[model samples]
Target: MRERDIEIYLRDEVKKIKGRAYKFESPGNAGVPDRLVILPGGRVYFVELKAPGKKSRPLQIAQQKKIASLGCEVLEIDSLQGVDEFIAKVCEGK
Candidate 1:
């Protein structure tokens, strides 16, 4: 599916699990993830959505590393399966 479709599915699934997925944007800091998902019990994560077969750019990878350094998880989702996998991961240990 398309990137937007993946994002929409992800957001909807997050809500079903009683979480919130916000569109994330950093004006000066480029390569930020697309959505910030917040779950119960203080669970938080970042997700970068891309079209199927697409990969993260170098700068996006760099930014992901930076975000990881801050102790936050960053994931890249390129397909519907990826979104399902992410939901499963985040929903674990809840």
Candidate 2:
């Protein structure tokens, strides 16, 4: 139940739905979300992956809030079930 394991699962599942889960990194931008998920029909999301029962750090929360202020979707996926729920919600009606 490490963070990387959850990340790999999300990437694999997103691929199954023909989406891309990119490792998102911004140099000099500490606390940015970990993944940039782009689904079909131009749906995009910024995803922060954490270990099971782990919460985001304060700076991460700030970054996520800034992204949300831009009217974009931000997700915090800490488990495989979270990934599945994300796909089911966003990929609905596609």
Candidate 3:
């Protein structure tokens, strides 16, 4: 499946568990990741979805690390299952 396909899948799945999901779309964000999901309990997660065999761009990697360093959570995942784990931990309001 394509990245968008998987992204939509993840969004819907996460919503079922977390109550809401959002995708970030800036007019000219050249290197930002695909989505930002906000859960019911006021927590946020930055998700970068990629197809199998794909990797994050350098700037995107740097951004993810920067977000993590700020004590926020970011996930770079290739599979929907990995995304599920991320949602459960970061967005599911456990």
Candidate 4:
């Protein structure tokens, strides 16, 4: 599927679970993740959506690494299954 399809699915799924998936943008800080997902119980994740079989660019990887270094989770979702897995993960321990 296309990246936009995956992103739309993700947003819909997250909303079904009472979560918020906001379009993330960092002005002058290029290559940040595409979405900021916030779930119940204070769970937050930075998500990068891509087309199937696609990979993040080097700058995106660097930005993700930087986000991770600050003790936040960064998820790269390139397929429908990846979005499912992410939703399951967010629902865990609830």
Q: What tens digits encode model 3's per-residue C-alpha lDDT throughout 2-90?
A: 78777988888877874566777657555666788777667777888999668999988987887789887787778877776776666
Question: Which whole-number lDDT from 0 to 100 does residue 21 have in model 4?
Answer: 98
| Candidate 2 accuracy as lDDT | 0.95
Off by more than 4 A, model 1: none
lDDT of 1 by residue, 1-94 (tens): 6899989999999999999999999999999999999999999999999999999999999999999999999999898888888888877877
Instruction: Indicate the TM-score of model 4.
Output: 0.97
User: Mind giving the per-residue lDDT tens digits that candidate 4 earns over 1-80?
Assistant: 78999999999999999999999999999999999999889989999999999999999999999999999999899999
Instruction: Estimate every model's Cα lDDT from 0 to 1.
Output: 0.93, 0.95, 0.76, 0.95
TM-score-better candidate, 2 vs 4: 4
**What's each prediction's TM-score?**
0.95, 0.96, 0.80, 0.97
Q: For each predicted model, how many residue pairs clash, with residues at least 3 apart or on different chains? A: 0, 0, 0, 0
Deviating ranges (above 4 Å) for candidate 4: none
The CA-based lDDT of model 3 is what? 0.76
Tell me how far the alpha carbon of residue 82 in candidate 3 is from the true structure, in angstroms, after superposition.
1.6
How good is model 2 by TM-score? 0.96
Tens-digit per-residue lDDT, 1-94, candidate 2: 8999999999999999999999999999999999999989998999999999999999999999999999999999999999999989987858
Ten-residue stretch with the least lDDT total in model 2: 85-94
- Best-to-worst ranking by TM-score: 4, 2, 1, 3
Alpha carbon lDDT at 64, candidate 1: 98
